[model samples]
Target chain A: MIVGERKPLDEILEMVKDAKKILIVGCKGCVTVCNAGGTKEVGILAATLRLARLKEDNPIEIDEMTLERQCDPEYIEILEERAANYDIILSMACSIGPQYISEKFPEAIVYPALNTCFMGGAQEHGVWAEFCQACGDCKIHLFGGYCPIARCSKSLLNGPCGGSADGKCEVDKEIDCVWHLIVNKLMKQGKLDQLTQVKPLKNWTTSRDGGPRKIVREDLKI
Target chain B: MKSGSNLEKLLNAGEFVITGECGPPRSADASVVREKAKYLKGYVDSVNVTDNQTSVVRMSSLAGSLILQEEGVEANMQMVCRDRNRIAIQSDVLGATALGIRNMLCLSGDHQKFGDHPEAKNVFDLDSIQLIQTVKMMRDEGKLISGQEMAEGTEPRLFIGAAVNPFADPFEYRVYRLAKKIAAGVDFVQTQCIYNMDKFKEYMKQAHDMGLTEKVHVLAGITPMKSLGMARYMQKSVPGMDVPDEIINRLKGVEKGGQSKEGINILLDQIQILKEIPGVAGVHLMAIEWEERVPEIVEAAGLLPRPTV
Candidate 1:
């Protein structure tokens, strides 16, 4: 799931400094699951911004709305008629929300209140760890279901670079080397032979390096 | 044959090559590099120039290598993926080679947190292994990684080098990793700083068992720990490096100022043992911030009057 965090109050204040009326739009998709742009977070953020503005004698007229999902155009259409009623729309969702809202409602001034981080899931209650890089070429099954692209600091595909030590990545001791994890799993599963063969240079066409990717489903196409 | 680099010539002739390292200064001033090069001059075959090592802003390795070239000291320019994409990397490769740099060490540099700029964004478009493949393609195939053909007579014939750490984890897989690099067209390898002789010997035995020792030159890395404090720091803090407790104890046994001397003795002993190891082709001395002691250390290790050819 995509994870993001609320941008600082100062930056958000700067973006909506001239606005007297603001609409805070949250997403009930990945941002909601990550607790970043959920409805509760939207209420909390709206209150904080209002209190901050009221204390400065510049009261902000704010209203809260949580879209079922912002990335989809149909959900974003719910706000099309009301988007022009405010000076600005504060998107408390992942980067995709503001973009879709802005693209759909070109007349609305959409500001992303959250900084989109990565596609990851929660490791624990308050901790989220990145697990996928969306390389589009999913070969995790080959490495015992571990995604080196997201976990390994170097993102080495063939094997661990010379930076793995004590099962920790050289980038930081707290971080486990993804190759170490993969090799351990492979050895435990008696699939250690998979490592003997060096994987070829990754064909990056499937990656964002080539450009933004697209998928066409001919089977479902009309 | 590889761009007239003396280090390559030494290794090719079955000689134990001795290369040193010089980290570029944070400032643009070239005097620090020149001053450091003075100690290593004629005491080592080639000096490895670090590019933004540990992610601290420094005078680039290319410019520092040029400065060393002016001092009659050949440089092995180190390139890392933490800062540049393929465009900058390929462009810098051509630029450095045009400026007369013959050797390049490709690496996935240390992450930014180790340096002053921890919040900076990193561009690891290609790790060290891929970087080696890119350089090999450019030099041998005369094409960019994009596979675009270089203009006639535009290829840079470079002696490619990469770093390996026998001390890193999943020790059993380290040898096979070296084989992958040889297939990637790396000419020589300089390893991480070594203090664990037993483990490194085991690592080398596996490389020999895999028959990789004969295909690529392996230069064991040796850094003289300046004090017990330094040794302890490496054992606890430095990643991909291990300093054995016995060595730390040995340094502790020495008196205050004598720890550095004991450290030198320990490094000399490691070098001697590495020379006798079957697969070891050379030793790369990374004196770290202590570059001035290189001349004496080289002289003591019987590697003085570094080979001229």
Candidate 2:
């Protein structure tokens, strides 16, 4: 899931501090899974904001709506007519949704209520950990399913550094050594011999280092 | 008994005790939380650490509770059944008790559909009523839900609590539901954010008639609205919340130039009215980002401290 977190309450309060009419928009996609921006959060934020406003006696008109997927243009279309009802839109979706709103409604101010974190998976109930960097490449097949690009502090490909000790990352004892996990997985599969083949330096051209990238299939295009 | 235990004793002594909520920071930083805690420490009897509140990922409530405890403030660890099953919930309760967290607010929780985790599977193997029963069973029977004896012959105990929204659809039914929760072993009940004191009083009268007043502690939840737009959004969007037209009109009546301060004053007024309601045990202030303003509202409500306690 696209793991993210709500921005600090004070920051969010400031973002919508001046608006007379506000709409809290929630997304039901990746952000919902990570618990950053979704319908329930939108409700709580709306309540909290109301409480804050009530305390001040400067009551504002705040409403909430949730989109099936804010990042998708199709779902965002649902917000079109409703968008004009409020002066400001407080999107509880990931960063993408707010930008999409801004793009679609140039006149209406769009504000993000969540801090987009990173691509990760649920490690356990209520725990999400970063597991993918979306480097525009996939090498998990060679590394036994763990992405060093995301988990490794240095994104090392060949093996663990000399600092790896007791099967833990030396940089932080709390962090598991991803290379060690890779080695263990490879050993279990009798693919340890692959470790002898030194891997080349990763190419940064295809990733964010080379600016925005895109993928297009002629057959899939209109 | 520890000082914390003594505090619990005071709470049980029929004093007009106050409680509030403190949502942990979304980031790894604890400085902001500490600052807010410092402001709230002596004002309220206990502070609730909301668990992934509203299904938004936050710093663990366990860690937040420990921080409050270390700072010499009583902490109420809220545990929701929406995210975990019986085993995890049981272990977490036991762990919290070991860490000196004596108060617990059990909730069935708003569905993941309501939270930021709609796609996330919910674990409602036990509802709020069942969880309360489990806690009572553990404390009284020293056994799990399966009837197996707890390890080491030790069981967790807590000042069990729950939430009720008197403004929910079929309002009277919401009050009846509270009766059920109280009957199932809820020691205290903190209501959803209350915008209308009159409505709350009416609900309290019903609760009193039902004889729930003698059994369960009732804390009225109060939050100061920040702006006019916010008030409208809350009434329209917040499920199980009712923001009366008068309050909205009063807010809208304020001059545009002085809205925020006016809103705060209005909230303070509501708190004052809530304090006077005969059946109200106390108030649960949910300031959200305005945690710094809680002391002012409490003092304004004329509830600084009990001379007898």
Best candidate, DockQ? 1
In candidate 1, position B146 carries an lDDT of 74
TM-score of 1: 0.90
lDDT of 2 by residue, B202-225 (tens): 999898887888888788888888
TM-score of each: 0.90, 0.56
Clashes of each: 0, 40
Cα deviation at B306, candidate 1, in Å, is 3.1
DockQ of each: 0.51, 0.01
Point to the candidate with the largest lDDT: 1
| Chain B TM-score for all candidates, comma-separated | 0.97, 0.92
Docking class of 2: incorrect
- RMSD (Cα, Å) for all candidates, in order, is 2.9, 23.6
